[model samples]
Structure formats: C-alpha cells, structure tokens
Target: MVRIDDLQVFIRAADNGSLSAAARQLDLSPAVASAALKRLEAAVGAQLLARSTRSLRLTVAGERYLEHARAALDALQSGSVALAQDRQALSGSLSLSMPSDLGRNLLRPWLDAFLQQHPGLSLQLQISDRVADLYRQPVDVALRYGVPEDSALVALPLAPDNRRVLCASPDYLARHGAPAAPQDLRRHSCLRFILGAAVHERWSFLRNGERQVVTVDGRWHSDDGEIVRNWALAGLGIAYKSRLDVLADLRAGRLQPLLEGYDTEQTPLYLVTPHRLMLSPAAVALRAHLQQCLDAYLAGPRAGEGRNDSCD
Candidate 1:
C-alpha cells in the first residue's frame, strides 16, 4: 500500500500548483516535497506530474490517481470520526483553527467547558484571521466562515451566516453623518479587516436589489477584527462587521446602522474537517460540542446583539 504521507504530498503539490508552494503549506522542505512525490509515483508505477523550470503539470494518469488518493484519505478521516463517535471518553490532542474574532468572543466559554469535560483531550487552537490549510498543518478541524472552495473537505454548516449591519458609534456617526447610500461610503472613514484572501478582504453590499462592490479606503487598517471593532467603537470610523461581532453595541445605541436599506454581504459559518471515514475521538467531541454551543448561543438572548469589548 502507498503511504498516506506520500499521497498527501502528491495531493498538496497538485492542488497548490508548485512543489515549493506545497512544501511551504505542508511545512516541509521543497526537496522533501519532491522526494515524496517521486516515492508516490514509484509506488504507483506511474509518472504523475510533468515538471519544467517554471511550472508543474499533472498527467492524465495523475489526475485520475489524485482523485482516488483523495477519496482514500477522505475515507480514512470519516472512519476516524466514526470511531470517535463510538467511544465514551475522548483522549487525544485535537487541533482547531478559527478566525480570531469568533473564537475569542463567541466560542470561548464553550471551549472552556469542553476542555473541562475531556481532561485527557489536549487542544491546540490557532486563532487566525486568515484561513489555514487543513491538510497542510496539524489542525484536525477548522471553523471557517464562508463557503469552502475545496471539495475534498467535509463542511458541516452550523449557522445562518447572514448579512450584518455596518455602522459607527453614535458620536462618529453624528460627526461623519450616516451614509445615505452605499455610494456615500466613498466620503466616509471605513475600517477594514485587511487579512484573509483578497476574495474576503473587500466590502460588498446590495441596494435596490442591485449588488455593489466598494473598494473602501480606511484611515486605519488591521488584520485583527477586534482592533477594527475598537476603532469603530471609539467613533473613529465606520466598520462593516458581522452582527455576531457588533450586536451588543447596536442594542446599547453605541453604534448606529448606516444604509439601513442596503444588504450587508454575508458568509456562512461551518465546522470543517478532512472528509474521512475514521476521526479521532477528540475531534468528534469538539465538533459536536461546538455545534451545540453555536446553537445555544444563537438561540440565546444575546444572539443578535453585540457584546461590549471596548477594551478591544
């Protein structure tokens, strides 16, 4: 049987377009990536990739083989999840990645409770504003907002990732005046989340059933959502934020919504893991616990309102 690690290298190299990029994603050296690909090809007795000075191209056989290998890895992961489901006690390390804002404000309490329940389970959670690779890093699961591009991973939708109201603090809104239309934002100070892929970095809105993309100019830009939130709360500028992030402030009249008739671009939230047949007990436990926490949180009184984090 071909080693799973070799197949993983093969898949990463194919997906990422270069051995070097794949190596970086996988935390391996370029030579290690190349060697693994060679080993995989040899074990399969087929030339999988055509390599040149500047580019890597997949052979027809490589395409078919990649599909099969990915399926096999997915089956393995699914099986692990199933095995974990049968166990009464979870005992393993589970690594998770999540956007820093959501992890800190929304899921912190639930995570604490979960850790208490599974004393043997160790967690390594990396809170990031950018998306991390599930196959590349040691993360077992990830909390992703928006639709996933990769078909290989299994994404379980946990909540309605709906449009949120964008606004500034009352003092800022009073000074800057609320945007009468989406176009009016061009004259206002906008705070932006400058991290993540370019796809998610831009602000989008809809008005009169027409969609608009605004390349916003901000006086302050940061990768950290908390910092952006603070800037908005300080009445520095307008921030386009999720209701989950700004709900409490809205209720308290700290921030006032602008362009009330326009739609705020929304992204769905999911608990994603490698699609496989077997998942470790710890990962399974965390996934379920996260879902429950999310459900309870969304249903609770604080669901749509923002919580105060002025210290942010």
Candidate 2:
C-alpha cells in the first residue's frame, strides 16, 4: 500500500527534481527515500519516474499523478485542520519570495514580529528583485508590487493606494532646483532603475485627467531599488520610486516630493499564491497578518501628511 509519507516523498522529489535533495529536505536517508518511491510506483502499478545516474524525469504517468497527489494532500491537510480542536496554534514552515528592497526595508520587521508571535512556525525567505516562478520555484507565496501577469496564480491585494512618487533630497533640490513639471525632468539628474536588461527611464504621470511619459536620464543607475533610494538620499539625483519605499524619508524631511500636482500610476501591492486551495494553514495566517499590518500602516495618521511639494 502507498503510504502518506511515500506520497509526500514523491511530491518533494518532483518539486526539487532530485531524490537526494528531497530526502535532505525531509530529513530522510537517501536509501529510505528511494525505497519509498519504489513502493509508491509498485502500489500504483506504473513507472512514475525515469531515473538515470545524473538526473530524474517524471514519466507520463507520474505527471498525471502528481496533480492528484498534491490535491489529495492539500485536502487531507485542510480536513485535519478542520478537525483539530486547537486551531490557534499554527505549526509549519512557509517559504516566501519578495523583492530585495521591500524584504529588507519594510517586511523584515513585520516578519520578525510575526515569527515572535508564532513560536511553532518557521519561515524561509528568498529576497531578490526578479519575480519568482510560483510553479517551478520552491516558494509558497510572493509579495509583489504590481499586478500579476500570470493567469494561473491568485493575487490578493495588500495595498491598493501604493504608488511611485518622484522625489529628491533637500540638498539636491537646493543645488539643482526641483523640476517644476514632469517634462522638466528631462534636464534634471534622474536616477534610473534597471530590471533584468531593461532600463526604467520612462517615468509616467497623470495630470488633469491626461497621461504623460517623460524620458529622463541620470549619471548613476542600479538594478537594486534600495541602492537607488540611497543615492536619492545622498542628494545624488531625483528618483521615481514607490511611496512605501520612501515614506519614512519623506516624513523625516530627508526627501521631498516632486511633481506633486501630477499623480503617478498606481502599482498596488499583492500577495500572490499558486492556488487558493493549495495554500497551507501557515500561509493563510501570514497572508491575513500581512494584510492587517499594511492596512494599519497606510491608514495611519502619518500616511498622507508628508509632502513638501511647492508645485501643488
């Protein structure tokens, strides 16, 4: 008979693309993991994996069985949770992916507090600017800043009012006078942010119900948003950045908003998951916790009172 542990081992092996890696993750010996897979294949009466010395590939039968196996496991987990008398104590591991800037500057404290609240829970965080593949990567959820382009994923909004703001330090503005309008940014030193191979030099704004795109240039650019913010803080150049990223600086008078009359396009934040039903109890709890924290922060009294823009 195929055991639940065997199914779990098979699923982990499929996800990692290596039996040894799966065994390591599950704290099982390689021989035991191999035997589990063999027993699972025999019970199912089909060859699940095509194994070689160097690699392993899922057979057609394995590919079809994998989805069902995952669904069954999820259902079992949900049912177990439903039957449990103590639902407040959540115990499990959650893996998350997020941008480097938000992960370090914003979410780090929030996550630390969350971990403190749940002693039984553990977390694995992957910080990178690149968007992670939910289906292929070893992440349960991703906190992203824009609308998801993938139709297969489910996106839950965390912050709808989040937007990019054109900002510069007081010293920089004093030295080179803030741009009076979006078009005037062409002559100013605008720090550019690069993602992958693309340079995000085109800054967009909306004024009087009309949209405009201004192509700006700068002497320095970096792929990391945090670096760009640091440059802006040092009075290097103007930067078009997310308000959440520069909120504290703006409030403290280190950075001042530019193009105040013109509103930038909204880039709402989202908590993305692979599937709603596939979400573990730990993931669900974290999602709610994040939403509450973000909402409270955005709705606080200091949220909208920090702009020192003279243009508006």
Candidate 3:
C-alpha cells in the first residue's frame, strides 16, 4: 500500500525538481525521501520520475499521475476535516433512560439547558424507577443510581462519591419529630421502596465505623422512587433518597437531611451503555454535563440553604 507520506514526498520531489531538496522541504532525511519515491513508483508500477546524476525530472507517466495524485490527497484531506467536524458537533437523536425521581425532578434543568444548546438535537427520554433492560429496551444510554449489576454493560461513573441521604420534610419532622439515632428510626414511620420483590424497609447507616440496620415500617411504600420522594415531601414519612434527586427540595428547605454525621450507604451514579455507548458526540457531551451537575450535588448544601447539621 502506498502511504500518504510517500505521496507527499513524490509531489514535493516532482515540484522541487530535486530529490535532496524535497527532503529538506519536508524535514525528512535524504535516504527516507529517496525510499518513499521508490516505494510510490513501485506501488503504482510506473516510473514517475526520471533521475540522472546531474538533473531530475518527471517522466511521461509522472506528468499524467501528478494531477490525479494531487486530487486524491485533496479528497482525503477534505474527508478527514469533515469527520473531525462531525465528531465535534452534537446532532441527531439521543435516546436515554433515567430514574423516575432523578429524571423528572433533578435533571429537568440540565436537560433543558442541553436542548437549548443543541437546537438540531432531539431527546427520547424514558422516565421510570425500574431498572432499564438495555437488551430489551430502545435505550442507547441509561442514567442509574446504583452500581451496575450487569458485568456485560459498560458503566461510566458520573458521581462515584454519591451516597444516599436520609431525609424528611420539615413538615413531617415537625409533626412526628425526628429520630435521634438509627435505632430511633424503628420508632418513626420510615417511607420505604420496594424494588421488584424485595422490600427496602431495612435502612442502613454507618455511625463511627459501626453499621446500623433499622427495619422500620411505614404506611407508604412503592416500587417507584419518585413516589417515595413525593410521599416524603408530603410529610408522610422519613425517606432515604439520593442527594441529587432531592437537591432542589433540600435547597428550598422542603426536605431536611437527617443523620448528617452518620454515613449512608453509597449509591454511586453510573451511565450504563449496552455496547460501549454506540455513543455519538451528543451522548458523550451530555454525560459530561450530567456529571458536573452530580458533582455539584456532592459538593454539599449551598450557602443560605444550610440546615442544622446537628442530629437529634
């Protein structure tokens, strides 16, 4: 196969009318330029240059090939530039699956901003709390809170530092009072989530290296995480949720975080792709943007949105 570098060498040598001078212009050694010219001629099965001891010039075949070679190089350069531009620009459809709570509540603003930035792009978002089946679903990408269970799927960590936040509405806390400790949760109405067949009534927290598992009961329970968040917001019961899901609510003092001193179980968010994303430029850009939002959530509560860090 004739290399692009060899083609450049041939063109330069022909244009300059000196093999050694072409080497100087291309910043190549004289030997390398000579070898490239020989390789190009051999690949084409035609002697493109007629060189003697004193003078060098193109043969009859060389004059005919020069224009064609120049066009081939031009075409390649144009194709390369177009490919680069396509990669840089975001367009076309972005099919995504996201959790009900995070999708509907937390990411609405982020999605809005993204859409505004790319007018040519469109979104197909499936909002649900149930884990999306990449194989069965029409989703290109999925934003999930937990560590990816499927080893086959490619998981991109958006926020690896993300952890669950135990919280309740100020109204709910004002009514039922807050739990003083993890043990006290047993006495409180803890809103739970039911994933498939398993009930998540057992809330776990780490206090001073000791793990506490409190199995509390509540009247409100659902498979949908958003439902659990709504129930918590309506002052139904204490809900353990992702900080990113309830960041806006927390900022507005609608939900008050509990057990700040104690560590809640990690629920690192991941962007799962079925086959290494089959990802486009838009998908890659969106992932980066979403991660920034998640990072901001992990940065802790903002100023003036402060709550009493004291656990009671």
* Model 3 root-mean-square deviation: 17.3
- lDDT tens digits, residues 3-96, model 3? 9999888876776679987788678999999999999999999999999988899999999998788777767765664575576666689889
C-alpha lDDT score of every prediction, in listed order: 0.77, 0.84, 0.81
lDDT of 2 by residue, 1-312 (tens): 779899988887887689998798678999999999999999999988898989998999999998888788778877865654255687878899988877788778788888888899999999988889886677889999889887547798888779998999999999999888888998999999996789999889998889999888989999888999999999999999988888868877889998889989687899998665446677777888887777666654453554322111
Instruction: Point to the candidate with the largest lDDT.
Output: 2
| Winner by lDDT between candidate 2 and candidate 1 | 2
Task: Count clashing residue pairs per candidate.
Answer: 20, 0, 1
Query: Candidate 1's residue-wise lDDT over 1-312, tens digit each?
Result: 599888888887787768887788768998988899999999999999999889998999999898899888878867766765686577768788988777887777678788888788888889988788776677778888777889867788776564566889989977878887777888888887865545233578887788988777866888887788889999999998877667657777888878787778776778787654324667666777777766655554554345322111
Q: Runs in model 3 with CA error above 4 Å?
A: 1-88, 296-312
Residue 83 in candidate 2, Cα distance off native in Å: 4.7
Candidate with top TM-score is 1
Q: Which pairs in model 3 have colliding backbones? A: 180-312
- Alpha-carbon RMSD of each model: 4.9, 6.1, 17.3
Candidate 2 regions exceeding 4 Å error are 1-88, 301-312
